[model samples]
Target chain A: MSTVNLIYFSWVRERIGKGEETLELPADVVTIGDLLAHLKTLGAEYESALEHQNVIRAAINQEHVDHGDPIAGAREIALFPPMTGG
Target chain B: MTAPITVRVQRDDFDLAAEVAALTCGRADIGAIVSFSGLCRDEAGALNALELEHYPGMADAEISRICHEAVERFGLQAATAIHRFGRIEPGKNIVLVVTASPHRQAAFDGANFIMDFLKTAAPFWKKEHRADGSAGEWVSAKDADDAARDRWTLES
Candidate 1:
């Protein structure tokens, strides 16, 4: 079991009711996709924030990564909705 | 022989003319400079301001990466992008992109490329603040923005 820091932004943060947290990932949580699925089982807030995992994007260590990307040795991970800047 | 590239994410507003002058001043090699400034629009007089949020470390890195790509792809001498976070009043500048090149077309296209990618790739989000003392919802990603960015990929 390894701990990973999770950061949420924008609506994802609002739905989760917190901006950041640290959680111990189960051994099975080896990839970003695995982490997302595992997170959905945590609670109502996790489920609500991650209900549309398809639209939500993830960044590992501040760099954007696909869901299939490995989570090994990652210190920081952020989840948020699509960007709307310009 | 590329000039310096600057990328900044701040809560403070930027001075357009000053920023442009800084890039072109004392540089005879730069013959053309194009700049684009994105302002906060009221949109039907209902919006008072736009509140921008960003992933601090990621915003800088992503914008810098895109600006670098624009400079290389467009053969630009220099490129700069500034994005403002926090509440920006209507008509105030929210983002700025400036590109300097030896020719007019490169300068123009470089600025456009930076703006297109910044719209969809940067880790920034905007929420409208309505004039009626009500907070508006966050703006969703537009398909048009993705299409705009995708066009570049197809072109390459």
Candidate 2:
């Protein structure tokens, strides 16, 4: 088993009621898809924000990654909106 | 060899010209400058007032990454960005992006690119302040903003 740090920003945080958390995952969860599935089980707040994949953006260790990317070696996973920065 | 970027999160107004001078100082190759200022529109007609909030450390770090990518994508010499968090009144500036380059085209493209990416990629949440004095609901992210950002990936 490995522990991963997750961060939710903006409305995701508002909806999820948290900014960051650490999770312990089974070794079978080796990819972002696996992680998303695990997160979807956390309850209504997590389900609502993540139910629609289009609105959320993901970054592993501070660099953006696609949904199909592997998360096996990731230390930090952050999710937020598409982005609105200047 | 020094840091070529500046990023800030504040509630105060900024002087555009002064900031630009600081960015372009001692760099003779910088022949052009372009900047964009995002303001709170009282009558955007779509939403009332907007309350913007951001995660302190995370917001700054992500914004710096976006600015760095903008500099490379547009061949810019330098870039500066500032975003104001908290309750902002109508007609107030909310964000600013300034880019400098040897050519007008790079400067212009860099500024536009940064704004487009910011609107779609930044992590700020807006709570709409309605006209009735009672707060309106949160404004969902617009598809148009996402489309605007997509155009860039295809072009470059």
Candidate 3:
């Protein structure tokens, strides 16, 4: 098990009630999808924040990645909705 | 010479003329410049302002990546992108993209390419501030924007 920093943005952060947190990952949490699943078990806030798994976008070290991507040695991971900037 | 790409994410508003002048003031090779400014609209008077939220480091990095790609793909001489965060009122500028190229078409295409990609890839979000003193809502991401961005990938 290892610790990693996780960040939430926009409504994800609003519902999670915090912008970031440090969590100790279980050995089974090998991918981003697994992490999201694990987070949902922690509390209702996490459950609400990640209610829709498909639309939740993830970024490993600030670059976008698929949910199935491995989170082996990432220092930070940010999750948010689809971007709306121009 | 390689194209110069400038990507800035800040809270301050930028001047259109100054940015263009900085990139093309003394250049003889560049003959065309295209600048696009994205502004905040009042939503037919339902909104007072827009609050832009962004991931600090990633916002700048993602936009820079998009600008660089646009410059290379269109053979632009220079590309500059500036995105503002925090509360922006109606009619104020929120984002700017300027591209310079020897030919008019490249400059236009380069600016358009940067905007299309930035809208979907950049780590920024907008929230509406109501004028009637009610709660504001986070603006939903539009599927139309995703469709717009996808056209570029299909072309290349």
For each candidate in turn, the TM-score is 0.98, 0.83, 0.99
Q: Candidate 1: give the clashing pairs.
A: none
Worst 10 residues of 3 chain B by lDDT: B22-31
In the range B48-145, model 1's lDDT, one tens digit per residue, is 88989999999999999999999889889999899999999998999999999988999998999999999988999999888998768999899999
CA lDDT, every prediction? Answer: 0.93, 0.80, 0.93
Residue lDDT tens for model 1, A2-83: 9999999999999989999999999989899999899999899989999998998999999999999999989999999999
Worst 10 residues of 1 chain B by lDDT: B1-10
RMSD of each: 0.9, 2.8, 0.7
- Candidate 1's C-alpha runs over 4 A off are none
Best by the TM-score measure: 3
Return the candidate ranking by DockQ, descending.
1, 3, 2
Model 2 C-alpha lDDT per residue in residues B1-156, reported as the tens digit of each score: 433889888878888888898998887878898988988887656556678876566667767887899887777889999998887778878998999888899889888887777776666777778777774666577778878779888986
Model 3: fraction of native contacts: 0.83
* Number of the top DockQ candidate: 1
Off by over 4 Å in 2: A84-86, B1-3, B26-28, B44-48, B133-135
Q: Per-residue CA lDDT of candidate 3, range A1-62, in tens?
A: 99999999999999999999999999999999999999999999999999999999999999
